[model samples]
Target: MTGPGMLTALWLTPLIGALLVVVLPSGARRAARPLALATSLLVLGLAVALTVGFDPGGDTHQFVETRPWIPAFGATYSLGVDGIALVLVLLTAGLMPLLLLAGWHDADGSAPSDEGEHDGGEHDGKRDRKKDDDEVGAAGRRAQVYPALMLATQALALVAFTSLDVLLFYVAFEAMLIPLYFLIGGFGGRVSDGVDRAAAAVRFLIYNLLGGLVMLAAVIGLYVLTARAGLGAGGAGTFDYRIITAAIGDGRLEIPPGVALLLFAGFTLAFAIKAPLWPFHTWLPGAAVAATPASAVLMMAVVDKVGTFAMLRYSLPLFPDAASTAAPVLVTLAVISIVYGGVMAIAQTDLLRLIAYASISHFGFIVLGVFARTEQSAAGSALYMVNHGIATAALFLVAAFLVRRRGTREIGRFGGVQQVAPVLAGVFLVAGLATLSLPGLAPFVSEFLVFVGTFGPYPVAAVLATSTFVLAAIYILWTYQRVMGGPVAPGLEGTPDLGLRERVVVLPLVGALLVLGFYPQPALDVIEPAVAHTVELVGGVR
Candidate 1:
């Protein structure tokens, strides 16, 4: 009970676990699975404790931990939880263990092969068996890396969210790209279908790294501005977000509005690429399609949230005047992403890719709400992040299960699934409905809030954005009809329903979605103060 505080432990737990996993011996693969799971669970428990112990009545960083990491550069090891970081942190913790469990496989469980047969007469069987063995090996390798890197990514993201110092936050923010690069390239590259997984990985890295490099420049610029502010004669600029925030507030650090726009553009490019708004989203569908269900879930549910989170945390607060001036343009992009993602999703034959595009559409809502600059919209954006994570995780998990059984994500490859896997189909229905923002579900409340707040300020954009629902419903129901309603596919006549392990992994997410849908007040209550504070910080620019 008297262990490390929430923020400290959250940062260290996964780092320690990741290091242990790397050093683990050859025979320790089995242990690696459980160790990773335990570490993730422990982090989750700490997050829950933090949530329970959180003071909903007040809005400030809680469970604070700060230490001088580099005194000369003005960087520090600083961390604390506000509502936005807190919810995202908890969601990260919740999903890492599930990724591990879904990917778990024993050595003996590998597919058997006939390559060792002694006669030419067995050639056909031999070829078939080798295919099976290769499939097993590929899956095994994926299982090992996906979950481990996911935890590492979570660790980096948590650090980014909690860090009070600008340089530290920037480092953490950029460091996350490394694991995710591997997640998409290394983990996704190995999947058996579609264009080369490596190709998809390369595309993902090239686009994201380009965005990251731009952010690096902005970070240095901000540091220079901060360092020049205080010391009388000659002072080296510092890269501390809190110090910079204070400097900006006092009007001591005056950046040319054009320079501010340039820096904002850098940061915006990075987050937008990650959020995958409109034109920049081409890498996403391929990455998701090539990735395993577990990997897709982590990428869509947790990793993408980093972009939205950075926009809210860094961009708007650091460059409020610029953000306000650019809101109209950004909102336009959000509207296009909404419709474009939905339309493209409807055309995808592949289940994984469809879900990926759908997420693009959903993310448009989050961006719209943030830029709308209303308390209600900001609060809704915050809640939508949590809701999206849960709904997406559920959808991807079910999609993964279906792919394993049918050996394809093609809508044409599946049919009458509900008759065979009633439970799975039911869960899929729930996830799909949540995506459509059906009344009584998590997305409904959040999406409604986004529209309500944005419509007042950007009515046309809001109305155009609402078309996403029609588009979303079209894709979701189309998928359902193609995959679940007709007579069962040839090889899937007796497909197994969700196993106990799969159920154990998925049920919690389902319950979470339902609970949040009904009583989102807890998350909303905690975020209101932070949202208001953020709005006020940006409002001062005018």
Candidate 2:
């Protein structure tokens, strides 16, 4: 089980599936979704199997695989998973089948709008006619690509999580943007009533590309330094992650302080933009709101986790001393992200944007845990990644269902939703509670660990971060009250509760939130050891 083939299958199954979807003939296009779903389900099976086979107390990187990807460039196609990488990989794989299910009909033909546009009929202007035709024409083609893109995203994310070569990881990291850009632009959930989806998509791509471009330079610089240090065989530079981390961990490799600072900054900036900390976060809300709920979940829950995960995997271990010195500054930014996102979320009129901002706040907590550098904080950060994915998927996807029924995302437009759609309202409440890290839920455990861990080293920052708890309650409960409490809002009079398909999409996520909430030890057990190893590296940075 711990070999080249098992890990390769984890990513290859989906990549092959995506290619299969793309090649489907028009006549067999109807089978596209089922085929894609089957492929995701298969990938999920592989992930579960891999998880079972993983020996947490065993090697740091299990299911190890390596092949020469580029000999002259000193890059190898290497893949493996330590406990930290394992959990994130599991998170990515676990969510795909669900995301595919969540966006089940996102590519289907849209229903006619309530506006009487068809009444204009042949008398309508040419502009209206062409728009209508374009809308109709977008359906079939988009359906084929929709699942294909999702599969591609999942494939790249898996590779990113497991890659042991900096070049391999960077390639997968940047490639993820393409599918997501299209998802936001073409399959938008009608962000703020269909305004600026394309703009949002372009912004998402541009912002991430900038971050990646800077990282590319840092990567090249690090490789040259390694080659000069002769860390590779016969003085050949190597992009091997294991070789670099081992060299850096021991006294064998010493990077100049200034150069290390520059390199670490390059790496952290990319991750910050990806994690979307503060100023770099403007792109996140639009992308999240524009993409369909399932795609939004993929972006935030699965895709965004890569950014935070990379911070743990690459940033800290690769540039230990630099990270040690930078921790205070990074923690300060995390605190700012916490307070600012919480404040912004409280002010949002759009449900999706509000959720997106809330995620920014949550990511702040995760980063705080990571840089806190204690065993408790690092382990918490890893566990937080998994729990956050579940909570966000449930919260955001439930809201999507509600907004779909009401035909609007404006918060002020709804009230007393519980009277008509009790299940929807109830589930939404639980999901919201999870987001706010309410006690006895999964998120509370991780959030609590992060606070306790950070308090020992950064007490003021820890206290400041506590502000999110109150802010979260305000936004989560107030939104719930406005949308689901009091007298029913106009046009929601007979709103239906969760349908079979919608329930299928939501119930499992809700259940996962509860199950992990009550008992998160199993996840923590697997995450702690890897975190301890990483802490050892950072701790000895001097």
Q: List model 2 lDDT by residue over 507-540, tens digit each.
A: 9889888989999988887888788888887883
Clashes per candidate, residues 3 or more apart or on different chains: 3, 1
Model 1 Cα shift for residue 403 (angstroms): 1.1
Residue 230 of model 1, lDDT score: 59
Kindly report which residue stretches of model 1 are placed more than 4 angstroms away from their true locations once superposed: 1-5, 106-146, 188-192, 231-234, 540-542
Top TM-score prediction, candidate number: 2
Error of 1 at 488 (Å): 2.0
Model 2 lowest lDDT segment of ten = 110-119
TM-score of 1: 0.91
User: Candidate 1 — which pairs collide?
Assistant: 166-241, 227-237, 227-238
